[model samples]
Target: MIEIGHTPAKRLVTIRVSGKLTSKEYDTAVPEIEQAIEQSDGKLNAVVELDDMRGWDIAALWKDLKFDARHFDDFRRIAVVGASGGEKLSSKAAGALTSADVEFFLRDQVDKAEDWAAAD
Candidate 1:
């Protein structure tokens, strides 16, 4: 399951994933991110925090691929926080989603990640 939380002023969005993530859960994630993108006028900042998050369903991977293929520029920066091997794998999966212009940072350094995400 994925739980989405938005910061005030619509400047930042955080996605928390717990348990196995299926395509359905992934599908549910889009609207929140899309809304955050819209609020940020296309160049949005986001944090994908994975705590107690398990592996992803095959369909979720497909959904992620499609999402990246279509809305590649919506994200300005993506910070992934994970502690487990599955989280590491999940973070790597985002490589395909990143573009030359997009900044992708691992979630290890919280302060640095926040500073990077907050950059104009």
Candidate 2:
């Protein structure tokens, strides 16, 4: 499951993920991300939390790539939650984020992640 929360000024978009992620999750969240970026005048802070996420589907990988291609620059800073212990999920996230401008964090580091996301 995924949920999107936009900042008051709509300059930031935070996506919280729980359980397994599928194409449906991407479908639901991508539009919100796009809208936030547009509303923020091409500047955005994207916070992604996958603390409770089990895993992702194959097609979801392509969706991530598509997102990166479209918002690599618009989404200037990204806070990635729940990548730790060198798990497969974490490894996959690390790989996917190679082309993105994201600050990675463990599940327990929400405060630090938010600090990074809010940094200039």
Candidate 3:
């Protein structure tokens, strides 16, 4: 499952991912995400929690890659909060492909993660 939350100002978004992610979720979320970016004046900050996420479907992977490619510069910063050691590493690798500054935090450090993401 995937849930997306936007701050009242729409300058920041929280993406909560749990269980398994499917292409259906992306189909529903991508438009909302684009709207959020627009509302935020083209760039947004994000906090993505993957602590409860199991994995992604193959089709979802393709959708995600497309989104990333299209919106690489739409994010100002991304704080990835999760407990998975592997995800932390993967986020670092992904950061290389985007203009956004990316950081990783343990799930326990959510407050700090949010603070980092919220900073201008």
Candidate 4:
């Protein structure tokens, strides 16, 4: 499952992920991010908080790749908050696949992650 919200600074979007993410969730969440990008005039920052998120479903993974390909340059920064080993690898992959600056934070440092994502 996933929950999407915005920071006080509207240009920053926050996504909380838990359990196995489904394609339905991606279908719902990606559009919210797209809207944020549109409202921000093509660029935005994002902070993804992972809480016991095992991984994505195959269909969700496909949706994720399409979204990333379509909006590769629409993100300014992406902060991933998690403690799992895969989180670091995912962050590196994201950095390599997109122009956004990607950073990983331990679960306790979510505040820092949010601040970094919202930074100017």
Point to the candidate with the largest TM-score. 3
* Runs of candidate 4 exceeding 4 Å displacement: 8-10
| lDDT (10s digit) by residue, model 4, range 13-101 | 88999999999999988888777788784579999898999888999999898888998898998999999778888888879778999
Please give the TM-score that candidate 1 achieves against the real structure.
0.76
- What lDDT score belongs to each candidate, Candidate 1 first? 0.70, 0.74, 0.89, 0.87
Runs of candidate 1 with Cα error greater than 4 angstroms are 8-10, 100-112
Q: lDDT for model 3, on a 0 to 1 scale?
A: 0.89
State which candidate has the highest lDDT. 3
Q: Write the per-residue lDDT of candidate 2 for residues 1-120, one digit (tens) a residue.
A: 889999836367888988888998889888987877778865787778876677789898789877776655676677778765554356456545544466678878887877787666
**Cα RMSD, each candidate:** 2.9, 2.9, 1.2, 1.3
Which is superior by TM-score, 1 or 3? 3
Please give, for residues 1-120, the per-residue lDDT of candidate 3 as tens digits: 888999946389999999889999989988988888988966899999996788899999998988999998999999999887898998898898689999999999999999999886
Q: Predictions ranked by lDDT, top down?
A: 3, 4, 2, 1
Between candidates 3 and 4, the one scoring higher on lDDT is: 3
The TM-score values for the models, in the order shown, are: 0.76, 0.78, 0.94, 0.93
What TM-score quantifies how close candidate 3 is to the native fold? 0.94
Deviation (Å) of 89 in candidate 3: 0.7
